[model samples]
Target: MSKGEETKTRILQQAAELFNQQGYAGASISDIMRVTGLQKGGIYNHFQSKDELAIQAFDYAIASISKHYRIAIRSKRHAIERLQALIAVFGSFAENPPIAGGCPLLNTAVESDDAHPALRERSQQAMNSWLNLIRRVIQTGIEKAEVQNNINPDEVATIIVATLEGAMMMSQLYNDTVYMQRAVNHLNHYIENNLKINGTS
Candidate 1:
């Protein structure tokens, strides 16, 4: 990449981490400067204002999370395996989150409520994308006869996302991996016993 492009990417990356760790209101331009080793002029050159930077940073954070999901489910063909891979990916975050603090979607969702329109919209889009992906996976499973035909993809996806996010919140709040593990284990059990075809699992 060109020098300016590289610097822009560096600024976005640093800002993403800072926002994930400190929230949009908590993280300052000075903090971003410190993280990126860039002056205000440098930052402003790339982004028009803090709001723009926060929006872009949120996008970067969600992209990083999506990348993690892509890597986790790359080789999994079946819907069950793909869903299991997602749970494993979330489980791994207890120790090492994709971004610095934790799930950006969860963090930003909590902080951006009525505070940041663009950022909150970005978070919502990320969540919608996640829910859509899960629903698609479950739909594919039904088509392939890997999952129960009567299963509702949208409802299952909502439950899975809700469970995973809640588990992540509890795990981070208590600084305990056991919470995440328990939630993941329960999700796995539900998937195996409830979603999958009787003989397929």
Candidate 2:
């Protein structure tokens, strides 16, 4: 990458961490400058405004998490395994978060609910992609006769994602990983006993 491109990328990385750790309202230009070692003019040279930087930073954060998800699920042939792989990624958030603040999707969604329309839309799109991924996995399993035919992919996907997200919030709130562990355990059990065609293990 060229020097300019490299600098822009670095700024995005620093800004993303700041915005995720502190919401759009809480994160200020000074904070970004502090983290990135870039002056206001330097930052504006790349991004037109703080609003623009925030949206791009959010995209960068989402890409980071999506990259982890893609790597985790890519090699698993079985639908259950793929879903489990995704869950394991979430389970790692407590100790090895992809982004420093937490789940970017959750953080942005909550903070941008009414305050920022642009971020709200971006978070919504990201969440839709996640739900669709889960839905596709369940559908594929059903087509292969690997999962129960009666299972509702949409409903199950919501339950799984919501459960994991909620568990993540609890883990962060209480500073205890047991909350996340319990959620992961329950999800695994639900998949085996309820969704799978046969309980293999």
Candidate 3:
């Protein structure tokens, strides 16, 4: 990459970390600049304003989360195993957060509500993408007879998304992983009892 491209990427990476750690509202352009060791003019040369940087930072965070899930799912061959792998990814976050600030999607969603339109939309898109991926995986499991044919992929996806996000939030707030663990346990049970073929209960 060119020097300019490298600098821009560095700014975005630092901005993403700050946004995740503090928040869109809590984090300032000065804070980002301080973290990146860039002058104000250097930051402005890449991004027009702090709002633009916030949007880009949110995109970067979402992409990171998506990349992790993609890798986790790709490692599994079976459709059911892939779906389980996806859930396992979230479950493991309680023990090992992918990013230091916990789930970025949940963080942005909570903080950006009615505050930053661009950032909020970016977060929403990320969540929708995540839900759609889960839904597709469930659909594949059903088609392959690994999951029950009668299962509702959309509903299952919604529940999975909601439960995982909620768990992450609760875990972060309480500074405890128990809620996350319970959420994952329930999620695993749902998959085994509702989705799995052979009626394992």
Task: Please list all clashing residue pairs in model 3, or write none if there are none.
Answer: none
How does model 1 fare in lDDT? Answer: 0.91
In candidate 3, what are the lDDT values of residues 74-182, reduced to their tens digit?
7686766787788888888877876678888888888999978888788889888999998888887777777788888999999999999899889989999999889
Q: Give candidate 1's error at residue 168 in angstroms.
A: 0.7
Candidate 1: Cα lDDT at 63: 88
Q: Give me the overall lDDT of model 2.
A: 0.91
Off by over 4 Å in 3: 199-201
Candidate 2, residue 176: lDDT: 91
Model 1 residue 176 lDDT?
A: 92
**In model 2, what are the clashing residue pairs, if there are any?**
none
Query: How many clashing pairs in candidate 1?
Result: 0
